[model samples]
Target: MRRILAVLLIAATTASAAAAGQSGKPRYFVKAWLQKADKTFEHTTSWCGPDQHCLVPIGEDMIELRELSGSSYYLRFISASSEDTPCCVFRNGSREARLESEYPRVATLYYRPEIWGGRGVTKFGRLIIVVEDLY
Candidate 1:
């Protein structure tokens, strides 16, 4: 009886974990680009995945997508708004991206002042926008 109960518990736990992983979520692993909101500037984050040369422009917003060590992805936004800039995420089909903080400050994302567009010309402070997960 004891052995049976232990086996059942382990099986149940494994099934639950599998279900969680199978949850429908978008996983984006591709190469993309970004241009500034103004015609005065434009940049890219070295390529999210492949440098196959099919570079596509996302917009004039100084931003890029990167994969985290945790197998998640995030968006890097350049802004200087202490008021917290809120935005939503959208993609063509399967690639999913979710906005992090509805109330974002400069440190909301990954802030690297040393990077290009790190010193954004926004009246607001450098915004460290964080996007949650490819899942």
Candidate 2:
């Protein structure tokens, strides 16, 4: 009877610890460039994947995306040239990528958020900026 109680206590402790770990995880977001060749696509902020590429104009307001999780994200790009040409790009990660094999590019940009969670106060209001090539 004592042994069973001990085991139950251990299991409860373990479960609580796991839940705490998950809650402690900081929320994340990615800022990436939707288009490669467009100079107007260059910008920076908290709205991109850690491994994704970023393209923005030389001088423009930097727009960012926030609240990204589980290796997947929703990408919406407002065309710098045409307001009527806004595009929505759904970028996902490796884990979520397996869900859709047809569009390989739709996979998430960052694989591990813990490794690339970025710096500063990530919980309340934080932003991580990364620049790369999407090729």
Candidate 3:
């Protein structure tokens, strides 16, 4: 009985969140700025929502970032989905890696920091800076 209620509650919350995302409320955005070898930059940005996959392509790979309702966020690499290879990672402002791991990690930012960002590396060792905004 308790388990059923929990499942139902989660389902209801997710459905409402999906609706809110389409309602034009302040949504989360995942922006990427990839530096090329010639010093030029390639940019891409996508809005995120609960249970939705927002992909920003970098070279042949892609950085996947999404928000869970308005509560938390998730980050990972699409190409590295089935492998243990580290394709991307969240980092602090100082360029120090923060949420580094061999696999995807669900990041729950209850405090809603202004910026929860990350970086992606291409096959040529170029840099891709990805920023996830709280609002």
Candidate 4:
């Protein structure tokens, strides 16, 4: 009876682990480019697996994405917002780019400096982010 109970417990644990791994969560590989104080760019890469949220750090700020499916993604830009500088995507140093879909694509974000805010160009310059699905 002891041997049978031990076997049953092990089997149940294994099945539960398998079911957790089979959960519908997706995984992602991310590459990001952020500008430094000297106007140069820096590259950072990371992975967002099923065990954690998809939060990519760009310098001191962070960008989060959720429910990424097809051409739709929910995005959030977290930065030092005391300056009230809005974060947006820029193209070719001039034109702005939309932060929409298509896997393995590049999106550049620009944080403009607030003229009257004391933050003094908090998170300035361009931030480029690339996302690839690894599920």
RMSD of each: 17.2, 19.6, 16.1, 15.4
- Between candidates 3 and 4, the one scoring higher on lDDT is 4
Q: What is the lDDT of residue 16 in candidate 3?
A: 29
Q: If ranked by TM-score, best first, what sequence of candidates would result?
A: 4, 3, 2, 1
TM for every model, in the order presented, reads 0.22, 0.26, 0.35, 0.48
lDDT of 1 by residue, 6-120 (tens): 3333333332222223223333322222222333322222222222112213233444444443233345443332324432222221122433322221222222323324464
Q: Of the candidates shown, which would achieve the greatest lDDT relative to the real structure?
A: 4
Candidate 3 or 4, higher TM-score?
Answer: 4
Minimal lDDT window, size 10, model 2: 120-129
Off by over 4 Å in 4: 1-26, 36-38, 51-53, 80-123
Off by over 4 Å in 2: 1-26, 29-31, 34-41, 47-67, 83-135
* lDDT over C-alpha atoms for residue 122 of model 3: 27
- List clashing residue pairs in candidate 4: none
Instruction: Show pairs that collide, candidate 3.
Output: none
Listed per model in order, the count of residue pairs whose N, CA or C atoms clash below 3 Å is 9, 15, 0, 0
lDDT for each candidate structure: 0.30, 0.27, 0.39, 0.50
Query: How many pairs of residues collide in model 1?
Result: 9
Model 3 Cα lDDT, one tens digit per residue, 1-135:
535533333333332223323334334544444443346544444445434445556445566654433434355544323343333332331222233222222221111123223233223223333343355
